[model samples]
Target: MLKRIISGLVGFILLLTIVIKGGMALSISVLLLSLLGLYEFNSAVSKNGIKYVSIISYTFPFLLFLMFNIRGLGLNIQIILFIYILSILSILVLKKDLLLNDISVTLFSLLYIPFLLFHITLLDGNKLIWLVFITAFGTDTFAYFTGILFGKRKLCPELSPKKTIEGSIGGILGSLLLSLLFLKIFNIEHYVQLGILSIICSIMAQIGDLAASKIKRISNIKDYGNIMPGHGGVLDRFDSILFTAPIVYYYITYLL
Candidate 1:
């Protein structure tokens, strides 16, 4: 418990620093995290003893960052789509020993970790980015305590035995409360819209947590990495954010 609290505090400080010092600071931070997450994911997948190439895994994240930052170059959606198709075909042809499963999981990791997380950089100047953190980490914090206090029935016994229905409800309520506080602090006056978004983010955050757990179960590993004393790794810590950020981004972008 002490280890968890210490690690959470240190992480919060670092995240607050990067978020407050947005721009290249935020970009670099996201890049480093994406890279580390990719590394952890690749390591986890490799535990299944599947042989595959990681060249694209390493290279495409930079390309994704570039694609987002270099807006004036007129990089259209079609071009990005073509690049993905070409990359997949190249992998299928060149990597003879690699099977369909290898290509699928590797590509999925690319899209999952770095690709989805790159949205944070896109939200560099927006205060709503904080909502991403609040929904993700806040849910996690509340769920942990709630589970310890009143966790009775298992939420998903196979994926994660520790999770409970009570904990999940606590997480949602906690996320909604924190989100409302953020909205009030920021003086944003869209209670109806933001309220809906908070609920959606909370539910999605839990799904994201479950999804990460499923990955670990399939990989037959304990944690993604041991970077944090109690939290496991960047991916483990930010899995909820990865799922929630994109949702919040699009919500604020189109809906609100």
Candidate 2:
């Protein structure tokens, strides 16, 4: 318990620093996270005795990191993905050992970890960027305390036994409070819009947690990795952010 709290605080400090640094620093941090996350994902899959094109999974993010850091790189996604898919298929054709499931898992890993996580960079580090963390952390922290205080019914026994319906609602309330407070502090308008956004984001955060939990259940593991002592891995810690980042990004981009 002590270790978890300490680690969480340390991580928050580092995250604040990165967010403040913004620009290239944030980009590089996200890239490195994607790389490490891919490693963890590939390892988890391999534990199930499944094979995949691990190199390509690693390579694309590295290239993306390059593209992000370097201006005028001229490397487009269509071309990169075209060649990547072709390479994976060619390997599948040539290598009797590699199967379709191999490539499928590989592709899924890329999308799940790096692709979704990239939205943090796409967030572009403005006042709104803080909303992603607020939604994720607010829901998580409040759900935990709320569940402890007033949890009676189970939410999803199959995936997470401790999560209760009451707790889920608590999560939303927590997020709403935080979101409104942020609006107050930032002097941002649109109270109704932010309220709705908080609800949607809170639900997304829980979904993201369940998604990661589902993968862990399938992988037959308790935690994803021991990278963060009590917190498990990068995925364990940031799973909610993975879902919320994109939602916030697209919502602010198109809807708001």
Candidate 3:
């Protein structure tokens, strides 16, 4: 318990530092995080006896970041899709055994970890960037205590037996309250939008958490990695953020 708290504090401080120092600092931080997350994910998948092409597994994420970071590069969606299709075709040609599984898992990792997380950079210079962290961490904190105090029914026994339905409700309520507070703090009048966003983000965060838990269960591992001592790994810690960032990005971009 002490280790978890200490690690959480240190991680929060580092995250805040990167968020405040947006620009190259944020980009570099996301790049490193994406790399580490991909490493953890790839390692877990490999244990399932799924093999991936080393070059594609590592290089594609860097390419994704480069595409996002370098503006006007003409490396738009169509081009990116082409590259992925080409990569998969190459895998099919070169590796005949388990080609479909290899391609699917590799592509899933690319979309899941780096591609989704890249939206944080897209949210640069927005005050709502902090909301990403708030929604994720707030849900987690509230869920933990709520489950401990009033948890009777399991949320999803198969995926995560520790979670509870009451805890999930608490998490959403917590996120909504935090969102309202943030709106007031920023002097934004879009109360309804913020409320809706909070609900969506909280649900997405829980789903993200369950998804990671599912991965670990299938991999037959306890945690993604042991980098964070009490926390599992970068993926384990930021799984919720992975889903929330993209949702918030699109919401703020189009709706708000």
TM-score for each of the candidates: 0.95, 0.96, 0.96
lDDT of 3 by residue, 76-150 (tens): 656786798797778789766856888888888888988889899989888888889999999999999999999
Candidate 2 accuracy as TM-score: 0.96
CA shift of 177, model 1, Å: 0.6
> Which lDDT tens digits does candidate 1 get at residues 45-137?
898986545887777777776777777877754676578758877889986787888878877887888878988987888989888999888
- Candidate 3: C-alpha RMSD after superposition: 1.3
Let me know the TM-score candidate 1 reaches against the reference structure.
Answer: 0.95
Please give the clash total of every predicted structure, in order. Answer: 0, 0, 0
Clashing pairs in 1: none
Q: Write the per-residue lDDT of candidate 2 for residues 20-139, one digit (tens) a residue.
A: 889988998999899888888888888887896887789988777766666588876666678788988888998899988889999888888888888898777577888899999999
lDDT rank, highest first? 3, 2, 1
Candidate 1 lowest-lDDT run of ten: 76-85
Worst 10 residues of 3 by lDDT: 52-61
Model 2: residues with Cα > 4 Å off, grouped in runs: none
